[model samples]
Target: MKGIVMEVYEDKVIVLAKDGSFLEVNRDNRDLDIGQEIEVDDNNKKIRGRIIKRLASIAAAFILLITTGYGVYGYYTPYGYINVDINPSVEIAYNLYNRVIDLKGLNEDGNILISKIKNYRNRTIENVINEVIDTAVEQAYVRPEQENVILITITEKKDKVDDEKIYKLVDSHIKQKIENTEVILIEGDNNIYKRAREDKISPGKLMLIEKAIDLNKDIKFEEVAKKPVKEIMRMIKEAKREKEKKEERKKLEKKTEKEMDKIEEMKFNKSRKAKGKKEDKLEREEIEKFRKDKTKKDEEEKEIEVDKIEKYKEKDQRRYLKKKSQDEFEEQRKEKQENLIINDNKKNQDNKYKVDKSEKKNKSKRGHENEYKHNKKERGKDED
Candidate 1:
């Protein structure tokens, strides 16, 4: 049956079928993504029944191919491949049923290790891997006292299986069976596997070499390709550490630069405030000086005005005294003149009175004589 992959998990894929039904199928190294179309076995039967049917079909195909004289070739045909690298490089091929079909050595140490394994064919892939590790341990290829690294790279001929399950099974088995060994698992495509084979190296080693070269561009592939897996991994680890340290240093430098910039800004603002204060002080001093000068000028003007008033008062007093003295002298001269006139007039009148008195006395004397003569004549006449 065909369906669209709706969701994918480590060991199962949720597929949406055309009949609007959902099916959960076991994922065995199948590289599936959401929305991709895939062929799945019918879900009507139980998973055990399906496996039995599949096995029956294989058996029938095997019998048919045996009658055709091509049974061994068809049974040994690989559906997936795994490359194990420790210093020794070994490759294992498995058929559709996940049974090991072949094993090959890529180097001298790998050849020696494989020669020690008595029987690997027709065994489960996990059992085959266990035996291979056991053989390597027996040959001292994997020493517990030293830093042992095993790099496993898996590549499928078709997208019908989940490599993650296989990697987990192998990882769990090796960890239980071995100690003090680092196991690295890699899931690769046909292109990378083919390229690694062409370069005469395992895919896991090639991947490490590529990563190392990316970290340090000065490293050459040929120079590092011949090195052991442990040494290449060590180089990769040191390079990563150096990269991290450099990043941290750059961050610290940036932080220091920012702090310095902040300090400089504060200093600039402080200096600006100080300069402003100095200008303010100078301005205040100028204002105070102007006030003092104005005060002094006003005092000097008042003193000059007072002196002018005093000088005017003195001139007025002198003029008043001179005028009074002149008036007094004129009055005294006029009084003396009046007194002399009165005295002259009195003298003249006194002289006139004396003359009149003398004349009057003479007249009186003549009149009395005349009266007496007349009386005497009258008396004589009477006597006669």
Candidate 2:
């Protein structure tokens, strides 16, 4: 019969016939592949019951593999951790669903305490922690009459988890369950837990040791690790008070310095103002002195001008006097010459009058002599 190979096995091959029925045939040494057409003998055909049985076996194996993978993933993966320290240090590890997946003891006392508690399977983390504390109390690891300190450090591996809420819830629950016990809750991270594991101590104990060292630099990590939590808290308080006092002193000194600087600035401004006033006074004095000198010089120049004018007037007066004297002398000389000319004219007139009178008397004497001659001549003619 001709058929198409569907599955190949070591001893047999499953094939689909053209008639739409499945057949199981014994495999030969020849290479046969799935989906390849081939010829098989009708005698080699097996019953369909064997194919059903083989398919059922494969289905059962696949289901088992899936279930086992899920189981390992859920049980082995850690989501968060809680470190409980009370002298008996126990670290509990939980899965994503908040179920306790693992529990470990960090010390000998922790190991002993963990051995006493049984059946951690399927228990919630809160129940596991409460049981651990109750077991510790029963074992005399935590005493009620004395001072008991319980430190819980929580570290989360996922961001979606609310670490603060978990811390508050755990703190509130443990405080209610135990009486007269001091409970300290710390929210921690992966790095603190890793370092705690390396140091072979619980995370809560490691945190207290670190804080003690910060408060007192002289205290070594080994020394703090051996000390109790109460002593470390006391050292931190004292150191903080000292630091606050030093800061106050520094602030006071700064305030005093600022006041002194302000006073010096005011003094400098006052001195500068006084110097400016003195300079103004000197400038005014110099200006006044210059004005007085100018006025005195102008008066001296006026006096010199007045003296020059007086000298000019005196010279003109002398010249006028000399001209008047010369005019008077010329008038007197002209009057004297006119009087001399009048006297000479009067003398000449008088001489001329005396000569005329003499002439007239002579003429009369001549007339009488002539008349006597005529009379004598007539008397001589009469005698002849």
Candidate 3:
């Protein structure tokens, strides 16, 4: 006889059927309760026919399970989703059924419905389950296999962002520019993005963009940049150099003007000296002409004196160091003229022919000496 029966264990029933069976089951969570009667079939009542064999059935089921888990890549057409096991890293379970359905290529209405559910992320496992139920309510019921339901769902929760830590870091960056930088950059939990639990765009990236828009949107970066002490000193030195260059340029201009003035003054003095020399030459020529024009001559005596006078006139004027000034020279000349006053001891007219060559015509005997000739003539007549 062949037999089929159910025995309860752990609030669930397990079915066993036996007919010449092997009960060497390796792995199954079906432990039979002791002293429970199982349906049996016997032909001779000596255990030779058939009996309930739960172990054999469990062994067969286990062989099928491992084979399915390692199944090769293929199109999976699922009439309904039963139990599903998720990777531990996938924290959001609301996306589980939709991902599987999309991979399977479901209908249009089904796709949209799944998408809405996946968009709703729940922080906890219970919330995720509720969300999945809600998704089912939204979709019109098309009855599915009773055994096809979620079994195992693993999740990785995102780490909560510590606002305090973020605030400190932001303040640190801001404090570099402003004396009192305590403005908040991140507002709440949305700023915290967990990579393992979710693949989301980094929220902190928008911090710079947000800062671009503000009440006073004057973002100055130079103030934040730190200047090295050496660099600052270098700038100061450069500024000083520029100032010195300006001052030096002014000084050079002044110096050039002074040099120009000196040149002009020297030219003026040279011109004046040239004019003085020309005037002095003209005056000396006029004095010599005046004295020559006033000259007189004696008829025969004058002829003899003319050769001597011509010789004296052609000779260079004697350059004698003045024994004294013009006043002294004039006084001396007057005394000498008075002594030559046709003295009663007049020796020159006494022996004119015997006069020595040096005394021959020591003074003028022509026009300039006519005044002397009149004295001599008067004295000679008196002697006659």
Highest TM-score scorer: 1
What are the RMSD figures for all models against the true structure?
26.6, 30.1, 35.3
lDDT of 3 by residue, 9-124 (tens): 45444333355442222113532332122343332232222444445455456435323653211212222121111100112222221222221102343345446543222122
Q: Candidate 2's residue-wise lDDT over 158-206, tens digit each?
A: 6644656756666676567567777787778888888988888877788
Poorest stretch of ten by lDDT in candidate 2: 58-67
Residue 153, candidate 3: alpha-carbon lDDT? 19
Candidate 1's TM-score reads 0.54
- Flag regions of model 2 displaced more than 4 Å: 1-67, 177-179, 245-384
By TM-score rank, best first, the candidates go: 1, 2, 3
Q: Report the Cα lDDT for candidate 3.
A: 0.38
List runs of model 3 lying over 4 Å from the truth. Answer: 1-227, 277-384
What local lDDT does model 2 show for residue 358?
83
lDDT score, residue 53, model 3?
Answer: 45
The TM-scores, one per candidate, come to 0.54, 0.45, 0.15
Model 3: lowest-lDDT 10 consecutive positions:
81-90
**Best candidate according to lDDT:** 1
